[model samples]
Structures are given as C-alpha cells and as structure tokens.
Target: MKDNPLIKTLFAGSQPPHLIDPLALFLLVLIPIGALPLSPSEEIHLFLARTSLLIYLGLRSIQGLIWTGRRNRSDGWVTSISWSSSLFLGIGWGFLSLSWSLSPFTSRSVFLDFFLYISVYGLMTQASLPGKTVKTLYQFLVMMALLVSLDGLSQKFYRYDAYLPYLTEHPEKFDPHTLEIMKNWITTFRRISAHFLLPSHLAGYLILIIPLNVALIQLTPTLWKRVSWLLVLGVNLLVLFFTESYGAWLSLLVVFAFVLLYPLVPRLRRLGRATLQEDSPGQTPGRLLKTIPGIILLSAGTFIVLTLIGYSRGTYLWDLNAPDHPGYLRFLNWKSAFLILRDYPWTGTGLGTFKIAYPPYMLPNSTEANFAHNSYLQIGSELGLPGLLMVCLAAITWFLKGLTTLSTLSDPEDRIIYRSLFAAGLGFCLHNFVDYDVYIPALGLTGFMLLGLGGSGNAEEGEPGRREEPSPLRPSPASPFFNIAWPACLLGLSLWLFILNGKLYLVNIHINQVKKEMEQGEFEKAYQIAQKALFYDPGNPSLQEISGVLLLQLKQPERAARAFQKAIELDPKVPRFHAYLGETYLLRGDLAGAYVETKKAVELFPLRTSYQKRLEEISSLLEKYAVKNRKP
Candidate 1:
C-alpha cells in the first residue's frame, strides 16, 4: 500500500528518509533573505520565517514518529540530547520568566523565536545525512554570499536601498523612524547593510559563510572551481571589511589563523594520518601552503583599505576615547549590563527586557542602546545566571563534540568539512563576546544549522555511521495511542502557530497603515486605525503610544493622558511613555503632575538630552509663573 498523502507531504516518501534534498535545502537557505519585507520591522520577518520553518519541521517530526521504527540511527541521540537539553532548559526558563518579565510581550516574542530555533535544530539533526547536506549547504551559501556582496557593493557605491522596491511608492510610506535610516545613506562613512537591518548583521552573515566557502575551496577538484570559490570568498571578505564590524573582522582573523595553523599542529597532524597518508592526492601540502601567502596579502590589503577609510573619515581605528566610538559605547553597555545582572542574580529582569531595563542603569555620557553588544552579558542580564550558564554549556558541548568527531575522521573531505564547521562555531562564539552577532536572525540560524550538520554523524561518503541496514516497512511497535496522539497534537500546534502568524502579519499591516495616516496629518484616521489595531494586539505599547500622540494632537489631553498611562502600564521601563504623559499633564495645567512624570523620564534615561531639556523648560516655566503670581 502507498504511504498516506499527509505522511508523503511531510516526509517526501514512505521509506525512511536519510537526507534533505538539495532543492529543499536551497529553499531553506533562502528563508533568511526572502523573509525581509517593507511593511514591518526585521523582527517580523524573523517571526514569519521561524513560524513557517517550525510548522514544516513539526510535520516532518510527526511523520518520523509514525513511519520510522525508532530515532534515526545516524543521529547520536544521547550526545545530541545531552547538549540540546541545556538549550531547552535555558529557553524554557525564558518562557517561564514571562510571568515576571519587565515586558511580558517582549518576553513572549523572544521565547517563541528560541522555541522555533530549537525545533529547527531537532529537525536538521534527525533528517540531514552528511555528504549531500554539506554539498547543498556549500552551494547555497556561496550563491548567497555572492548575491549579498554584490548588493552591498551597489548600495555603498550607488546609494541604493535594496529594500526600496518592497516599499509602497506613497511618500507617506517614508516615515521618519523606519524609512529615514534608508533615506539617510550618504554620510562621511557609508556602511552597506545589503537587505539586513544593519551593517553589522551583514558582517555576521559574511563571517559565518567564509569558513564554509574555505571548505568548498579545499574540496574542489578542478582549477576553475577552486578559482570561482576563491573569488566568492574574496568578494565576501571585501564586503565584510567595508561593513566595519570590528568583532566580525577580528573573528575572521581568528578563523584564518586556525585554518592556517591546523595542519602545522603536531597533535592534530598525527590525528589526521588517514587524511595525510591515504588521501595524499587530494590533501596536498603544496595546496595548503599556497593559502598562507594569499592570506597575508589579503590581510595587508584589508589593513591598508581600513587605514585609508579611517583617515578620510577622521575616525582613527585606535581612537577609543571618542565619545561616539563603538568600542567606548560597548564598554559602557557592558558596565551597565553587569550592574543590571548584579540586581537580579538569580533570575533576570526578563528575556527581551534588556532594552527596557538598561537605560536607567546607563552611565553618564552613554546614549540609549538596545543590546549590551555582548551576547553572553546580554543573556546573563536578561535571563539570569542560570540561563547564561545553560546557553554557554550548550555551545561548549556542541563545539567539543564536533571537534572530537573531527579528530577521528579518516576521510579527507569529511575531515575538512568538520574542521571548517568547528572553526566556524569557534569564530561565532568568539564574535559574540564583543558583538550581538547571535541576535541577528540570518547569522543565528546559519550558526545553528552548522551545529546541526556537525552533530549529524553522516558527513563522509563511505562513513560507517550511515544507516545501511534495511528497516521493516511496518509502523513502530509503540502503542497505537501514542502514534495517533502525537501526530494529532503536532498537527494542531502547527495549525495554531500558522494562524497566529497570519494574525500578527495583519496587525503589522494595520500598524503600518496607522503610521502612514499620521504622517499625512490625519490624526482622527490614525487614531481610529490604531484603536482597531490595539483590538488585535492590546499589549502592544507602540499602538498605545500612537493613540496617545493622536489624542494629544486632537486637543483631548484627558484622553491622551489615559492613553499614555496605559502605554506606561504596558511597558513601564520606556522613558518616552513617561515623557509623553508628562507633556499631556503640562498641557492640562497640572504642573505638579507634569514635573513628577518628566522627572521620572529623566531618571529613567538621564543621558537623553531632549528629556533633560524638556525638564529644564518646564522648571523655568513654573518659576516664571511663580514670579508673576508674587508680583500680582
């Protein structure tokens, strides 16, 4: 009998599947790029892509449970589960923190993203076979690197916004907050973001793919193929340099050092006897030696380019004392993050609460920053020490396991691939210490995908770990109730998430429309649209803030005050909510209330010049009125 249509749709066949098809892998690789849209922020794109991937993986997992007799023999479930448990526990704690989270809505969103990523990790580890998956990944990554690099070059040189076509042509669509960043591209220092939300994000993406491309170059047999891969690598490295992400640049340097030194290490060389002796034809010393001169030349050229750019921009690379310097800002952020972590040592303020919780703790002269610029510190400050430990343990476990596996590999190609993956993982971890590389969806997903591939024991062409034994076509011997119940639960959950994603998309559309209306000076229409949007996502502080602004513009200070108060109640850590409420109070002639609210705003974000200025202006007005009253 043929397999069930539902099972077929999920699994691709009745036979136990070993690997994801290249075509499907190609589609998966494109998710990060294709998810970008103009209507909402980058987070929405991440949400949509993650939701879709999770749903698809959920279906495949259900099918695996029903059709397969046991867990895939190729997947080292014990090792995988050991490391994966840490990740799960960390994320689970994040979900639990929603109850006490500074902003439950933000916590909920973060938890969902982590949940989806975990699902992807499981699906990839179970389904991917070694050779084909690596090949497919390399092909797709090279193409993506080339495409993004070209786009970045065009954007930097031609001042083009790659996302412009996705936006509506209406001038109102060009709102100051979202679209202004796109419009203001011509600065003394132009950093290309490609389609990502920031230049640093593009740098993270390039850093991730660089090692994989290096592996492909090592594996290519033909001269032209090698040259082509090298070209892609060069282009990507060039773009990465122009992104001016110091963390990414440093990470790339570390990766290059690892690759260049690996063969020279006596212990590692001893472990690679099979690759050195049996596969001598493919693993040539001359080929490896050639990379050194090229790497040196590339390094020297990069330094020269950076020096010239720094000179022209009047931003010396060594100038850390500058008020606006990224290094100085990062130092300040780390200091504040440590202070916040000290306050909540057991359980953090909450996941995704760092942005809200950090402003009040910022040092003088430091501006508002969302992330701590250090992933480990950000996680520690947001999710507490326990969560931080779990995440760290998970990463270490994956790296060690992959490195151990690489040490034992006999196949030349397999050894290279595993070494590349391990190096990439190490680079990513190192980069996170100085930058929020892991927060970027494209980079984060790619990192996890590499880990999944590394965990799957089937990377070689003739590896003994491959599942060659035939399996019975019958269903698993587990209870019929489990078989039916599990799939039904998965299907239901998938459907629910899909529905929720659609609703969220609709809400974003409505919010965008409200923004457009407000830009056109249509306060009443904007207020109505915001009210309707709030019906869908009432906890959204943004929509509430919009309603408050519109109400203030309509001369309804009482209603506006209520709106701003509601916004503050939803997310109390935001200074803008308090500032807006203070303005409303001032308009209503409630001087005492106005002073109280404005002072709260200043206390929350003392470094914000505008808030301080507003406070000063109000104080002067009160003094003038007091003088007038005394004279009368």
Candidate 2:
C-alpha cells in the first residue's frame, strides 16, 4: 500500500499527488471480461470497473488529468498522440447525434462503450509505461487469448456448442431462445466463434492478437518466453485457420507484406522516419532480395502464394454468388449502408442505431443483416461523414506515429514491442474494411489500448531501461482553474453516465427476474418487477413490450395500448410492437386502427409469417365492421 502511486502521492508531506494503477489493470482486463457474464446487453458498463473509474475521475477532475510528478511540469500524450483529437471529435459526433438516433436507448447505451474505450486510451497514454508494465500487460492478454483459442480448438475437435453442457442445463433462465441462438452461433460447422457472438468476431480478435504475439517472440531475450509466445501464436494462427475468415487471412497477408516492405524499400522506410518509429517486424531474408526488381518479384510471389493458399483451402475470398454467400451478404450490407448515408448524410442514424435503422433498408432476401460489415461505412451511416473522417484521420495518425516511435528505438527488443502494436492495430484497421469490430467491445477496447501504446516505452538517448518523458506537442495551461474545469467536466460527465449505466445494469437484472417469474406463472410478480425495471430504463422497448403483455394479461386494455404505443416509439423497426398495439386497438373495438397498425407491422417485416396472418385477421375484421355499418 505504501508503494502504491496513489498512496505515496497522498498524505505525504512533500510528494505531489499521482493517480493509482488500478485503473490501468481494469483497462487491461477488458479483453477477457468482455466476453463473459457481461454478454450482450450487460455491456451498458462493467459495473465494478465503471464505478472505480468514476471514483478515479472524481478525484482527478479537480486536480488535473496529467500528473506533473514525473517532470514537475510534465505534459502527457493524451491530446498529443497523433490522431486522438480527431478520434475524440468523431466520438463527439456520436454523442451529439443521439438526438436524432432511431433508438435513443441504443445510442445512449453504445456511446458509453466508445466513451469508455477513448477514456481508456486517454488514461493509458497519460500514465508512465515501464517495460515490465508493458510486458505484464502483453503476457496477461496473450494468456487470455490463448485460452480463448484453445477453447475454440476444443469446440472444433470435440463438440458443437461452446459450453452447452455447462451453460444449457439451467432451466430457470428467462429466455431459453437466447441460449438456442447462442448454440446456433457458436456451432458454425467446423469453425470456432470462440464464445464470441460470431466466427468473424473471433477472427477479429485473432488477427489483432497474433501480430502482437509475433512481436513478443521477437522482443523477448529468454528462450522460454520466446517459445511460450511462439506456442501462443501457433495456436492463435491455428484458431484463425479454423475460423476460415477471408478478411482475417487476406488482411494479415497485407500487413505481413507491409512489414516486409519496410526493410526491402529504403525510400519508403526513410520517408516515414521523420516523426514516427519506423522499423520492420522481421529480419530481412537476404541482401539480394532488397533490390527494387528483386523486391517487386518477392512481393508479388509472396502475395500470390498467400492468396493461393487461402483460395485452395476454400476461403471464398471473392465469392461472386449473389445469394447464400458471406461475401455477397457483406456487399449487400455495404450497399445498404450507403443508402443510409445517402439519406442521413448529416448524422446518419446515430450511434448504435444502425440495427434499428438498417432493417428498413435491408435488401430483399438478405435475411435481415444488422451491422454494415464495414466499420468505416457503418460509422459514416451512423455518425455521418465528419465522424467517419475523424476516425480515419485518427487511424492514419496512429500508424504514422507508430512508425516514428519505431524509428527512435535503439534496442531491437523495444523496437519489436512497438512494431507488434503497430502491426496489430494496422491489421485490425484493414480487417474492418470487411467486418465490424467497432460493435465488439473486446476488439474495440483492445484496439484502442494498442493504439495508445503506439509510442509508449520510448527512452531518451543514453537512459537505458527508463521511461521517456512525453514530448509536449501542444501548449499546457499552468492555471489551476483551467485544470480544474476540464477535470470537473470529466467528473460530472462520468457521474451522470455512471448513474445511467447503473440504471441499465439494474434494468437488465430485473427484466430477467421478471421473465423468470413469468415463466413460473407469477404474472402479478412479473408485472411488479417489470415496473421496477422500467423505472430504471424507461427507454427500453422490450421492457415496454413485456409490460404491455402483462397489462393485457391483467385485462387492462387502455394501459396495455399505452405500453405498446411507448414500445413502438422506442423501436418502430420491431414488427411485434406494432402488432401488439394493433391487438390493443382491436380489444377497444377500433377496427380501422387495428387494420392500419397490423398492416404497418406486416409492411415493416414482411418475412414474419405470424405478422402477415395477424394483418389478414385485422383486415377481415375491418371488412366485417364495414359490412355491418353499411347495413345500419
């Protein structure tokens, strides 16, 4: 406790205050916990992590963000990290676009994820990064990835469901359908989703982790560490192979080629050396291969070899089949995303609103795709052009800065460490061209952390094994008030977000409790718990829909109509909300309203046979009412 940074800084006579390292570890644990009990909706915020972060922010908000304990006026890389401002601005657009979000609740929930990621990046960049600290973080993440990979391998060789026997035996779970869906997703024939929602998400995690592990193998001097990392990488690559993700395979090849080009092409290496850590990942094969013609031939040959390997293994990298092919679905989603951007050019549909806004634009026979499959296009369609531009600029900046950081490292080990981060981040960026890691917290959090570590661990000349002082790239205000203002804003924002996050988490808990009670024939109890849940997250449409069902069961048609009406407002894209509202209208003897509402439900989701039949029933009822009116 005495050795703790926060402990030393506080309650000591002369020492200046410093923030603690707990925040750092929380950010690191994000990769693994991202997959577990958190699941899909619980991502509102990791309750414990967020609470601790809020406390940290509350303490720092008044003092300042960057600590001066190191250099006694030290500036950190938070704002100065090449493209961070643009990244923040892009996320800023995501926050502001909430006003127009197709589903305000979804936008509100997802924006926190982006906020948490950027905050993690900011917090990481501000802290001092010792080599041991870097190595430990790398090791922990590698082990976690290794476990996930091994689990995936086990699934491939042994069973279909990821942990069906372990997870499926619970009869008390509110929604058994969710478990069935999870089983279906994890059981992608001979492929491993690795407990991720989809195989592609596991592929996303793999591509990012493998390069970093390769970097580790190069950096570690000890044979044991090298062998350990190599084993991890080998397993990771094998899992990647099992995933059979065309984007992961092709993107990795592109990155490997880029790494190769760094050594082969002197002009290119020298060109980016001005402000980045410019270095190659692996050793050159031979001097003969460095010449222009030789390099071109080697590059082409390598590219062809990798491409052919994937093609021969049934990669389907460019399947032109218009239907039933993954690539074609991706193409259709991209096309649909463009149409979304065409209409909502200013702000698009809003952050996390893509799924809500996308259905109306889904192409015929496309099976109702959610994500755009391209992170950039989705960002454009969801957050608008400025948001897209900012994110792109930030990415380009991180890559360039990574190059600069690489060039400055005198030690081969240090250079390799930075290179691995650079390669992993670049690979993820390129991978996003055909997939959406943006929605996956595990991938996005890891990506941002890697991006922050881009220029970390730099040492000043002649100071071996010491952390470098951050170069001040912008003006720092010495005023106490200015410092207090920013931190206060962070504190205030965090406080509000923390409250909302708590609400969301509690709502998830209570709603599940409600469903369990309902399953056990406790309608009154379920209704009571549902109201409690809605009090926390009134914007949740599913909760509202459930409440309507409960109200109808309780024989309160007016209240049921109002509940379904609220659900429709919260999520107009859902067919059932409109259908339920139509049911309430019919109970009230409003035949015309019932017909119109049911018709809209069928129109919104023509694929739902149940909705179509309901619409037909409403139409027949309306016709009978019309015939009776004519007779009167």
Candidate 3:
C-alpha cells in the first residue's frame, strides 16, 4: 500500500486517520460560525460547507480505491439502504421534473444541493474515526451552545443585536427588502436570532445540542465536569425559553421526559412483577392504592405549573387569530402547503418551486410565506407525497437503528452517548413539525453527522469470534474501469458544482447591486446590471421580471413587454409577469390583448386587488369602445 502510486499521491505519509477526525470536527464547528456572514442568505454557508465536504469526500474516494479496494459499510446500511433508495428515487424524480418544472433553474439548483447532501451522508458513514472524536465534537458543541446563549441573552436583556451593526454596514451585500422585513420583525417580536436569520433558527440549533449536553453530564465522572455541563444546559434552556419558540419548548419537554423515564422502566417492570407474585391477595391493590394520592397531586401540580408558565410567557396556544401569533401563521402556511399538494400530488410543482407555487394557494390576508414552516408539509408540497413518505421512512429507520445499537452497548458512557444522539435526532424531527430546521444547512449537517456517528459506532460492537465479510461495495477486478471512472466522475462533478455555485453567488451580488442602483433612481444603470445578471443566470424568472420593470421605468414598453413575455414563458405560474405584460399591452393600445393578459393574471391570483382592478378598468374601456363602434 505504501509503494502504490495512487496511495503515495493521495494517502501515504498524509496522516489519513488524523485527517478524517479533524476534518469532521472542523465541519461541526465551522457550519454554525461560518453561517455568521449575512451576505446573500444563510444558504451561502450551506453552499460553502457542501462544496468543502464534497471535495474532501472526493479525495477520500481516491484513497479508498487504492488502499481498501472497497466501499465502506456502516452497521445500519442493511436497514438504511431501503429508505436511502426511496429518498434517492424521490430526488431523482425531482431532477426528472425539470422537464415540466415552473422554474427549471430553481429545480436544478435544489436537486444538486440535495444530491450533495445525500453524498455527504454516505461519506460520513464510511469515514473512519476514533470514539474520542465524538467526545471532542460534543465538547465543541457545548462551547458553541454557551457562546450562542450569551449572544441571545445579551440581545434579550440589552435590546440590541451585535450582528445587526455588521449587517447594516454591508447594505449592498443583502436584499434591502429582506433587511427591512427583519427590522420590522425584531421591533414587534423582541426575539434573539443570534447569528441566524430568525430566533426560531437559534432555538432549533439549541434543541439539537441540548440532548448531547445532558448525555455529557451523565457520562462524566467528576462533579466539576457535570456542573460545567449543567451550566451549559441551563444557558441553552434559558435562551430557548426567552426565544419563545413553542415548538422547541414542546420538543424539549418530550425529550426530557424520555431521558428521565427511560432509566426507571426496568425498575417499574420489576415492581409490577413482584406485586403480581406476592402471596397476599391485597398486595397488588395495596401497592397501586398507595400511589393514588401522589399521582393526583402530581397531575394537579403539573397543570398549575403549565398554566402559570403559559400566562407568564403570554403564549395563547389556543388562540388561532391572535396578531403576530406563530401558531396562527403556521396554520395558514400548512393550509397553503396542503393546497399545493392537492394540485401537484405526485411529482409536485418541482423542487425549489415552493415560493413560486405557494402564493396562489395562500389564504386570504396571509402575509407572504416562503416556507411551509412544517418540514413534512414542505417536502410533500415540493416533492409530493412519495417524497414525504421516503423521507419519513429514512428518519424512522435511522432512529430505530440508533436505539437498537444503544441497547446492545454494555459500556455506560457509550450507551449515554448513543442515547443522547438518538434523542437529538428525535428532537430534530419533532421541532420540524412546526418549523423547517432540517432545511437549514448548519442544523441539517449537524443532524446527519450525529446519525452517521450513531450508525458507525453500532457497527463496531460485534461478536468476538466471527470474521466480518468484505463489504459488497468492493469493486471486482473485472470492473477496473468502474473503480477508476466512479471516483473520477465524482471529482469532476464536485468541481463543476463548485464553479456553478460560485457563478450563482456572483449573480446574487450583481442583482443586489442593481437593486441599489434602482433605489438611487438610476434606471439605465440598473437595467444594464440586470442584463449582465441575466446573462449569468439566463433562466432566472425573477431577474427577467426585474429587467421588465426597469425597462418599463425607462419608458421602453416594447422591450419591457418582451422581457415580461419571456418571464411568463419561463415560469407561467407567476401572476406578476402576466400583469406586467398586460400593462405593456395597454401602453401599445391593444385593448383585447391587455384584457386577455390581465384576466389571466386575475385568474392566477384572485386575491390580488390590483389585478382585479386592472381587469375592471380594461372591461369598462372595452365596453365604451364597443358602443362607439356600434354607432359607427
């Protein structure tokens, strides 16, 4: 192996084992902090992280080919494969939908991002690392929790966000409308977002780490370490409570109940058996009867505490129409998602098409919602019911496998670690019921890493005497071409993706620049910048729409019509494109054309008062023209 040319180039003298653990740890640390830059969107961090991980995997693939001559296996692969295959099929179907996708560019980008996530999941499972690496990662997470808690607590107490000043200084790098939206949001909510876009995002991140902190406290032998972990846990809980994320609060309660009750199950079972076997006829009733008063007191106490908490927190969970209520907004978003699923039940409108597809389905007076706010509903709306089913199956399989592995581990420390990872996974699932935490790259990566660790550790606890067979993933000697070609293709694809995302990043910068130019009343300069952006992302309907609007402002209605028509041709689902085109037709004195386009716009978005008003005005004009023509 040392003498092999491939090994020498990729792995030999490279400290391969040391590299794997550090790279994994670096990713766990980098994702949250790397997300601090507010340029473009939080998704930019995901793009950067995914690109780095993909490149790392590409290099590891070359090393694996030369040294191991086989694909690596994890303990859960047998069970995982079924669910993984289904997920791949769903993503594959998303790619296939590009043919009919309303926004093909969005569909392509989303498909690529998801495909990379799947690749990362596989790589994490295969990458070998020491058990101590997991411990190190947990410690790093604890530090992060403390740091984020400090930031959040400061914002809550001081009434100022530290990151807000930095964002304000870099106005040109982000969307002003988005910044304005956040400014308005913070004024009313008073919640802390920390380094993320929303307070709920911070809460979501904490929920993932909180369980691990609990596990660390249980596993550590020293009182000092336990107290330190307890402090970190308390900080996270305080931040979570102040953030007022009902979903996260509910999830924490459930996870805590599970963690506390899990240890008592065996004892409870023993007590039940002992009572059954007692010779005295009254023993079973006596044992049960003695706990009745305590049970009643406990239930009453719990209800009183809950009432006090709800009142102090001002959380009227039962109120559906309360202003600024998350629960009410979630209901509207979920209803919209259901409507989208009803229309596109199987294949969906297309991946990343939610923003375009959802507007028409929104409830009356609903504010614009980019996400469904429920991960399951979002997945169903974007990928359809089949995709939803596949994702659910994959999550359930991962959880069951982790639990099974935790049961088999005899070491108390190892059991605690696995149990905590399992609980973290469950928390992610539950939080997503009212939020889209899984869609956040940092949280999603953390989750996948924990799952990978759980599955890998499970594989190590084996029978003492049995010899493990070589993984079937090994390439046969007859398929030497495949061994070479597979890795080569992955490397090439990763490079291509890197370049593609870089272009998109530049395109976003240019679009933001154009917006600044427009605000300064430089229509010609704005139009020119938009033209350049369109050249880079030719299929972006939003860019096309922007170009149309700028051309209209420049009084070039003919060119504006061409741009709007092009936008509609690219993504016919958007009502705004039709309305813009109708205005251009009206400018050209084409009453029939204006009437037709505006009517289409109204049909697409019936709740848009502007579109309906335009239609009415056009109808009155047509009616007046009809009377004059009849007299002639």
Candidate 4:
C-alpha cells in the first residue's frame, strides 16, 4: 500500500485519516460503476460528471509523483522514456498532418488531443495499479452501455408513443442566408434527438459493443452474472434495429463474423483451450437455467413487435431508397471524397475543411452534402495518406495488442470481456468505411475509454507478476510515485478536453438555432445571433457569408460587397462568392464591372447553367450600355 504514490501523498506526514485499503478499492472499482446510467443530454449541466472524473484522475497523478520521489529517485527516467516515445510518434503525425490539412488549425488541435490520449495510455502503462484502473474502466463501460440502453428505450417507448414535443426550446439566431442550410437538414432525418443524431451513427455505436456484450453473456461464471449482461445486449440490439441503419447492420455482421472466427484461427492454438469438463453440462438444474436462450428470443420478439408498431405509425425504419431519403446522395459524396483524395492526397483539404470545400465539386443537378459519409476518406482527404496511416497504425497496434492479451489470458470471464470489446472496435472500424463517427469527440472519448479497458489486466485478481511479498528492493503498492502523477495528469487533460468539447457543442447548437431564426424572417434576431456567432468564430467564412448576405438585404450593398470579397479572399475556391459579387456589382449599375465578375463566376462553375445565363445577361447589358453612351 505504501508503494503507490497516490496513497502515500494523501497519508504522508499525517496520521491515517481513514482506512486507506478500502478507499483504494472503492476508487478503483466503484468510480466506474457509478457512471453506468448516463443519458444523452440537451442540458449543459451534465458536464459535471466529466469534471468530477478529471479531478479524481488529477489527484491520482499527484499521488504517483510524490510516491516515486520518495522511493527510487531514478524512476523519472522511466516516465521520461515512455512519454518521449509517445511524443515522438505524436509530433511526427502532427507535422505530417499539417502538410495536408485544409484547416490546419482544426487538424493541429485534433492531433494534439489525439496525442494527449496516447500519453494517457503510456502513463497508464507505467502505473502500479494498472489492474485497478482497467477494472475502473470496464465498470465504466458497462455503466455507459446501461445508460445508452435506457436512453434508447425511452426514445422508443415514451417518445415515439407520445410523440413528445421538443424537449428544449432554443433561442432563435441566424441570418436568412445561413438558415438555408437548415431546410435541407430538417427533411433528412425523421427523428433528430441527442440519443440518435443519425440512424447510421446509432446503429454503428451499438454494433461496436455487440461483441463485448456477447462475451459477457458467454464467459461470465455465475448464471446470474451471465444473465445480467443480457439486459444490456437486449437493449443495445433493440436500439440498433430501431435505428434501421443498414450500413450499421452490415458493419455489425462483418465484425461479429470476425470475432466468432477469431478463436478458431490456427495461430490461437497457443491460447489454452477450455476443458470439456469445465463446460456446463446439459443435465444439471442450474445448467438448464443457464441454457434459457428462450429469454433472449422473447426479448428479440418483443423488440420486433415494438418496431413494427412504430413503423405502422411512421416513426420507424429509415429506408435509404425512399424518395425522401436525403442520405441516398451519400454515394455521390463518397465519389467526391475519392476525387478530393486524388487531388490532395498528400495533405488533406484540412480538418473540418472538406464540408466547406466539397460542395462546388458536386454535380450541379444534385443537392449538396454536409460530409463525405466515409470517415477514412474524409480523414484521408483532409490530412493525406500519412495522417490516415498514422491513425490506422495506432488503432491496429492497440487492437492487436489487446487481441494477443485476450487470447493468452487464462480467465474465461476476462477473455470474454476482451473479445466483446475487440468486436466493438472492429465494428467501428468497418463502419468508418462509410461514416464519420470516429471524428466525433464524444464518441471518440468513449472509444478511448473502451480502449483503456482493453489494455487492463484483471482488477480483482491483479495483473500477472504483481504479487506483493514485501521486499525492501521491491516497491510497495502504495508507493506515492506509482499512483499519483499519471492519474493526475490524465484527469487534468481529460477535463480540459471535455470542457473544450462542451463549448464547441454549444457553439454548434447556437449556430444551428441562429440559422433557423433567419429562415423564419426574423432578420433582427438573426443578425443579433449571427453577430454573437461571429464573436465566437470570427474566422468562419460561412458565418461571414451570412453576415454579408444580411447586409445586402439591409441595403448596405457596398459593405455587403466588401464582406463577399472578404469571403472570397478567405476561400477563393467557392464559386458562389464570385456569383454573389457579380450580383452586387449589377445592383450598383456597373455594367462593365458586373460583366467581368459574372464571367468569372461562369468560368468557375461551367455546369451552372444559371451562372452562364446571368453572364450572357450582363454581357448584353454592357454592350447596349456602351452603344447608348457612344450615341450621346
């Protein structure tokens, strides 16, 4: 107990305040257990849970630093070695990403966050209580699953049945120009709640966890233990079906197949096999109870019936082929992503820059898309192949390491747990072939938590070779350095990211609301909200476009023209900027000037027949105006 730095720091130079052993156990086990019931929130207050967890980790890191200082003074080198390796890998990727990103600022920030996550893992590796940390994470995952399951249920049984009114009313804010984006979004999805942003994402999220849930049901020792996992599996699957995301369903099938086949691979022969005697026999009463696959069938049946009922009422099953299904355009987006990759393969357009840059390339006949549905393509287009390769390699390394561990572990329960997690990770990897969930910070954070769980040894039993016999040479489990520093650092970084993400979310929501207000003809409200948005994201060209359009509507053409020019300067590649500028020039009766600008617009977007028509109109007007002036 004295070897763990976190424990030592708390008790150092003071009498024991409480039973340290019990406290350590509680921290290791219960912190994760306590988090199982979270629901996706519209309220900002939910940020507290993340804040608390950060505080907990920060204290742990401090404990580790203090303990290490008192023990062997040479331990700093070990910390430095681990951090250095992580830093080198991270910086290498960051520089490579900078070379390709369309939005270098956003790319750099994401890479920084990615690097911090890697550092956390490295620090975790050096900690003495890795098993406990792992256990804490597993408990956290189980709880998260439970919460998602419950949230999905509420969305189905309560919301769908009652047709619940908007849960939270947002203030209106956005100019008429920006509100145009909302019209397309409103018709895209039937239900757009926090629980399920898009059908595919919901399906993908649940699919990722199916393998883990299955493992829990199969490998857990007691019949009760196995049965407990069924609730989570049942709920998650139910929600997945409700989502009706075909891509997610397809991804799940692929991942589940791989997981089921993983154990049968010849290379896995080294992983010891379970003896026939250990398998529960068919005859025992308790064993018969264990074979109640009937419960699973019933649960599934109930879900299907509920889904059918929901479908009858028009609240279920998103058909990708339906006329109203805007998602069908994803095929074009996918193609465009490849085209963009070909054009800028080395460095991407920039992180978050694809949406801003991709629309002009779309066939003039079709609707514009918000994203290239494929995450890998999106990342590849933004950061280039090297950045993509770096991320892929990191994920592969972590996954294979986890797989190797799972295969070698002796405990059936632990092995099952790992197999399930591996399945979820596999599902996400597959899903990313056609979706961008991996880039979502909230989802990414949860994924990293799961990744941490995958790296953990058995918490209750401790990791192999971690036994304490109390040698003067061997550090005590309670050593201050072993426990404190790493946890503290992790907590601090995690909190900072969470806060940053929360603020970002608020900005997105506010921006969306502002645009809606603009659409409703609330120009004053829209302008007010747009200004506020500008305050938060002054560099956003889209926001500037909105401000410029609104200024034009208010009869400030010169100022509006300047704003349009600025938008072009910010991103000259956008054809609309030229078109808008030409329109502004025409309004000012500068026929020659208008013709020049209009011709530029037509040249930039040849397929836009409207732009060509406008160009012809300007040319004719300029010619007539020149002839009339000569007559004078």
The count of backbone overlaps in candidate 1 is: 1
- Superposed Cα deviation of residue 43, candidate 2 (Å): 6.3
Candidate 2 TM-score to native:
0.83
Tens digits of lDDT, candidate 2, 315-402: 4445555355667778889998999899988878889877767756878766566688899999899988888888888777767666
Go through the candidates in order and give each one's C-alpha lDDT: 0.70, 0.69, 0.68, 0.56
Per-model TM against the reference: 0.83, 0.83, 0.80, 0.67
Give the candidates in order of lDDT, highest first: 1, 2, 3, 4
Worst 10 residues of 4 by lDDT: 13-22
Clashes of 3: 0
Tens digits of per-residue lDDT for model 1, 220-275: 88999999999988898889877877678777777777667665554654543333
Per-residue error (Å), model 4, residue 585: 3.8
* Cα-lDDT of candidate 2: 0.69
- Candidate 2 local lDDT, residue 212: 71
Please estimate how well model 1 matches the true structure, expressed as its whole-model Cα lDDT: 0.70
What clash count goes with each model? 1, 11, 0, 47
Rank by TM-score (best first) = 1, 2, 3, 4
Write model 4 residue lDDT over 269-300, tens digit each, in one string: 33323222233453444544643454455446
User: Measured by TM-score, how close is model 3 to the native structure?
Assistant: 0.80
Best by lDDT: 1
Worst window of 10 by summed lDDT in candidate 1 = 1-10
Candidate 4 at 545: error in angstroms? 3.2
